[model samples]
Target chain A: MEHPGEGTRNGGSFVVSCESVSFSYPGSGRPALSDVSFELRPGEYVGVVGPNGGGKSTLVRLLNGLLKPDSGRVLVSGRDPATEPFEVRKHLGILFQDPENGLVAPFVEDDVAFGLENLGVPRKEMRDRVAGAIRAVGLEGFERREPDTLSGGEKQRVALAGLLAVEPDILVLDEPTSMLDAAGRREVLAYLETLRAEKTVLHVTHHLEELVRSDRILVLNGGELVADKTPERFLSDADLLRENRLVLPVVQRLALEIGLSPARLRTPETLAEAILAKTESGTRAG
Target chain B: MRLELRDVRYVYAPGTPFEVEALRGVSLVVEPGEVLGIVGGTGSGKSTLVQHMNLLLTPTGGEVLVDGVDATTLKKSELRRRVGLVFQFPESALFAPTVEEDVAFAPRQLGLDEEEVQERVLESLRALEAGELAARSPFALSGGEKRRAAIAGVLAMKPEVLVLDEPTAGLDPATREDLLALILGLRNAGISVVLVSHDLDEVAEVADRVCALQEGRVRAIGTPAEVFYREPAQAPATVRVASLLRESKPEIGAPVRFAETLDALRALQGA
Candidate 1:
């Protein structure tokens, strides 16, 4: 709901900024990330996409102070994460690819409260926050359910609720919906659409369609920041998508393969309309 | 080899307060050398159903038959050898240091001589286009390579049937496409494939028949066009597009695959 570039970057404030960051795993031949630099203005929903080994996860780990960059710096709200991990953590909440792995507590309510407990929040306030967070993710009735027993969608929401309880400034979600089925994906994406209005979100995913609404899209390939463009501009380039090993959404791919401009027809309805218009014109011309 | 499940029922933690019926009398047949796609939402008993095919999880009630023989009477190891299961993120199960040893572990366990084990390992890696990765460490490979290596481990057993649960779950598009082609190639080589996936489009492209599960029961089972179009909202994008086109142009035929959808539109243009 919040228009990008409305009240963030121009005012000299960036929620997340990386400066010439480079990192490599120990004993690995190639650097996982090389000289990657980007900045996220407040309330900007950015999607990072690339091939599997292209360092999307590495960048996420670097942003959260989980891995130190071999060179360059990562800043959260202008504070260095390496020197101030706890302070940085308060501003960054990460929902890993596997929600089951991220979940620590047995019960949903207690899982949401785990973060607040670590923050040393008062007991009385923790209860309200936990309830609010659970409600935020639409898990109201699942408060007492064991996380292991819930459906995949519900478990993902529970993991999200845990993050929401902390009220972090930015949310870094790494393939949050990849493990989910169609219904589960819809559930998580719907919640994120609402959350994006208030939170600076950096979503990393292999599925490009999920980034259609993203304010900006960043492409990483072979450990480099390959492209940074608006979603419309980024997705329209069939060559770019192919070069990066990213596939277009079904409708978009259809549009491309059918000799139509990929940018013009995105959704199923529009594609159908375009086909109809083209056929009608062809019939008339013939 | 034909794999058949007759009224298979699987209950988790049976007879306990926390018991949950994961599969309730689900029945299906996997024909020889055909791709049988199993699709459902999360926790829809898709995984449970496939596990039953390989005897990973024995059905609590009813029968799982292989080629008209009851599965319980068949030796468990022999059943596993006849049917290989590749779980979701199967790469995580790779433990041997080198990709070669990891792939050879199963064949070696079957008491195949080292010479034959080495031959099977090479053949399996070649089948997955991962023969070059044999000397590489499993931990050092890329995600797609790791997946291929993991699958090669299953293929080394030379099972007649392969059941892959969400093979393309987290893969990039190119890798996903390659894996789908590999599934089809397996079928061409006289190996039946039971593909359990949440990706309907890919399933539509590869599956000879599709089985949709809803709440541990068969919601629909037929060709992709029959099952997918029956549930329009849940159908593959091509099928959905064709259906939408039909609203205005009633002549537009429903297409289950991408190429067929394009052909249908081209026919309209030609008309």
Candidate 2:
């Protein structure tokens, strides 16, 4: 959690900065978010996870200027989102929790082109952008297909393509894979991995496994920032995760139960290696 | 009670340009006091097959028998009352101002006396541990509370069997565990449960029997241990870990549950 005024490190500039942000829905008794602060470095993949209604969505909305904070400042790329929303939006693209809600056009290509058309980009350029986005999401052949008829995974890919067409530098996704099945989840995650090199992603999800590779994780509880650390440190604290109503990934939980350090065994492959090492050691000891 | 589907087949917009075969010759049974977990990928006809269980959609072909009586032959309302269907995102089903009113709506529609309807409402809320939300507006309640209230609406009808589609979707870990426990409680009380979910871990935990669906058809059906450990695609993460271990030590069985996997790992450590 670097401070907002801190000089840039490793030649990566701060893409998003939130300072003492707080917000409450109208007529609601309690605030939805309170005194939340964090910084997103360029090309950094950060995961936001918390219980439902824990302000994860609200925080992202503030970052995108969709919702103005009640008491604090939010800056996207050194510009105040509340005051310079259009300028901030130019560098940011967001994918919401429900893919159906984000899609508007009946056909896939139309939906992907809708944003570009709004920007009044020339027809030729729009065509190239749409095609490139569709290819990026692995939906090149689905250009004319009806979005409603496509499976959940394909529909999400179309939505992602629509976002990618704008060519934003930062990507904010709120539970993008929550509604999909196992195969669909795998597909979306796999596609996202390919973007890690070129994009700064702020991914909010309930699945802990999805965050295993994240550079940093922010844990929210009851509308407050509870923990900000590397994903390994955040997930290794079993009690902290349970108290915040987050479930550990199944393989990670098994590793912890067997007295293995989950921080070291982040993935199934590493868990297998640790087990094999233990077996070889036991054979030699005998 | 036993609910059986014999070679059930369903088609969407049949004979039209948009015609698509949703289910093809799917057969399964839900015995009384048991949880039948259905697992499938998207577009697998899991939702379509469950709709057939309660006659929400009469099969285009084959038979759906509710305790030996053809569901298609029964009145739609009667069949629905016997087999309560909870759709995915059950919170959308809540429309009444208050949770109590929503829960009582189904019983009142059955022409039950007002006193009986009131009793059913309270009982249903209690069954789901949602009695505290009785007077609250459904829209004002949190996501988890609203989901429980919606489920209570169907439970108030006192159905013999319950069908839930992706009941745990979009729910947090704690809320998911609570709902799973309630489903098991319903089974213990002799209410058959047909749970359709994509979460293999949850199915492995609560299901006595499991069925896998692929491309609108039944791919496999057996006990949870059999179905999950056998299917690599639908296996839980714990089972996958066991599969990796088994690659090195064949005698170390492919354990499906956390406890079994822990025991296997302990055995490896000692060996």
The per-model lDDT (C-alpha) reads 0.86, 0.84
Clashing residue pairs, backbone N/CA/C < 3 A, model 1: none
- List the pairs of residues colliding in candidate 2: none
Across A1-286, the per-residue lDDT of candidate 1 in tens digits comes to: 1223233434556488887899998878899999988888888899999998899888988887889999998888877888888888898999876565777887789998988898989888899999988987777877876776665556777888899899898999988887677767877788889887689999998888788889989999999999898888887887889899998978888888778887667677788888888988987898
Q: Model 1: per-residue lDDT, tens digit, B1-271?
A: 9889999998887786557788888999999999999988877888778989988998999899999999999999999999999987788899998999999999999999999999999999998888899998998887788999999999999999999987887788988998899999999999999998888889989999999999999999998989998988887789878988887787877788888888887787778
Residue runs of model 2 more than 4 Å from their true location after superposition = A1-14, A79-88
How is the predicted docking of candidate 1 categorized under the CAPRI scheme? medium
The candidate 1 chain B region of ten consecutive residues with least summed lDDT is B11-20
Q: What's model 1's TM-score? A: 0.94
Error of 1 at A275 (Å): 2.7
Q: Lowest-lDDT window of 10 residues in candidate 2 chain B? A: B231-240
